[model samples]
Target chain A: MARILVTDDSTFIRRRTCTILNRTGHEIIEATNGNHCLEIMQQDKPDLLFLDLVMPGLDGFGVLKTLQDAGNTIPVIVLTADIQDAVRDECMQLGAHTFLNKPPAEAAVLAALTDALAEGERKA
Target chain B: MTSAAHSSSTRQLNVLQKDAITELMNIGVGHAASTLHTLIGHKIELVVPEVSLITLDDYHQLQPYEADELLSTIWMGFRGGFEGNTSLIFPTDSANTLITALTGEMDDSPELDELRAGTLAEVGNILLNGVMGSIANMLNAALSYTVPEYMECSLLNIFRKNHTGNDTIMLARTTFAINELKVEGNILLFFKVASFEQLLISIDRELAI
Candidate 1:
């Protein structure tokens, strides 16, 4: 089980994602927006992050750009309703590992978690 | 600018520009329907969205219902790659039906209790965010949204509260359905004349029209 951070301004989405991850025996930390997301990462690094793109403060794109500039390699799985191809491509270019639509399928979340955590282990 | 001038300017949009705007609104509505389905674990079917562009005065003329009809509204302001005020307006009855469907609680009064109001705001957040996000993605612009606020007021008051000069309203009416239950609501996005001009320029560049 990996330690994961979930960031989203929507309480429902955050709680739902946390519930799904908890079922997999993973430790979950939640943040409401991009600024909070960065704050959490600085204090304690998680194995993976589930980030939402549209947020009140700094959005997911801002977070990704900041991480890339800081040379942080944390694998971020973007969770968002914005599924446009352009968005997907941009996130990937910004170093996102995978993209999942909001209210993600449990199986897909687990699969992504496995892939991201495995990558983290390999790098460590 | 005067309301008359604003109305004429909005009416001057060529067929192509109008069609493009409608297509963008449809994409946004599609995103909202999918998100709603995910949240409720219910299959949601969104009827084809109808987009209307009108001045606030024109909007007033279009309201045929009683002036005092109460509405459940979730309002938010957005800025960044695009700037606008967005509100999800549901008739009292429709709002009650939706809250009941989501929470399994029935309330006769149209006014949302605190718990129900919170749920409604969250729902509005997801729906509006999806809509605005789709538009932003197409424009390749980043957007920042204000926290959504829930209010119960008459339809006339709702408009009065959001009134501003040099505003063009884009109203998208769509029917949301989960089996037998149907909720029809309007996702109203109000853009300042200047901001809307920026939107048009961005669209032209993005679509290379």
Candidate 2:
């Protein structure tokens, strides 16, 4: 089981994701938006991050950039309801371990976490 | 600006427009409910006939409570000669409840929640856009859509900014048999007067031409 941080501006989404991860036997933490996510990230690093792209202030893209700049290599999963493919691809290219569509499949979420964990193993 | 031509063109929910719009949304949302039924493998009971229009003013008067005030919303901006925004909101409780159904699991699992939210967002996207896009296609007018913006908050507060203004809204209520989750809320459709008029014209032209 892994301690995973789930970040999105939506409460429904955060709770929903937390529920999913909890069932998977991983511990979960939640944040509302990108800024809150950063505050939490600075304090406790989770096994993985699930992020939403468009938000009120600092969005997921900005959050990913900040983490990357801070030299944080935690695998990030980008979630979006928008139609910005180019932006999503860039996030993946920029170090997002994987990108999945909004309302991901259970298989996809597990796969993403596994991939992120494996990447962490390689880096370690 | 609410000019004569603009005011005249921006008609309220006359019986026809109201019913037609509502009916179209019914077709759209009915389709969405169908998608949910298939995706989650649950029997969902929904009524498109319940769709209606409300101004931002009436929206506030209908003041709703945020069960888990911490917010989560799926949003998409739509524009063309017409412009609008469609949002699918799942409060915390609703999210958990729906997740339970979609996963076919009785317990609340964190990973399932995440997947559920993502699934809801996709489902919302498919539902909202499915209806809206189909409407646009019927009119043969072009609309550009931005990816959905996922958000959270005191939903009541989200609409406080322009509550006095006239805004078209579509509220969707969905109930799934498996989890017995009752998800009901409004989908706000905001647009400038001109854009709305353009949308009407598109519809009219689609009907006539």
The candidate maximizing DockQ is 1
What is the Cα-based lDDT of residue B86 in candidate 1?
Answer: 82
Model 2 chain B poorest 10 in a row by lDDT: B1-10
Give me the overall lDDT of model 1. 0.75
- Please give, for residues B1-209, the per-residue lDDT of candidate 2 as tens digits: 11011222234544545455556566655655665665666566653344334444444333355333665567777787577666666656676666566556665567555556665665567556655655665565556566565566665655543234555433322222334456554444455445656765665665565
**Model 1 Cα lDDT, one tens digit per residue, B1-209:** 12122344444555566567767878887888788876677787666655555554654543434567778889888887667778888887777778777667686455547667867877887788788888888777777677788898776776665557735655444555666566667776666556766777787886784
Candidate 2 TM-score over all chains jointly: 0.52
List model 1 lDDT by residue over A1-124, tens digit each: 6779999877666766888899888789999999999999999788889999877779999999999999877899999766556678889999999998766789999899899888878877
**Candidate 1 chain B worst ten-residue window by lDDT:** B1-10
Tell me the tens digit of each residue's lDDT in model 2 across A1-124: 7778888765555655677788878788988789999998888877788898766678887898898888877788886544334555668767788887555567878888888877876775
Q: Candidate 2 regions off by >4 Å?
A: A83-87, B1-7, B10-41, B44-82, B87-209
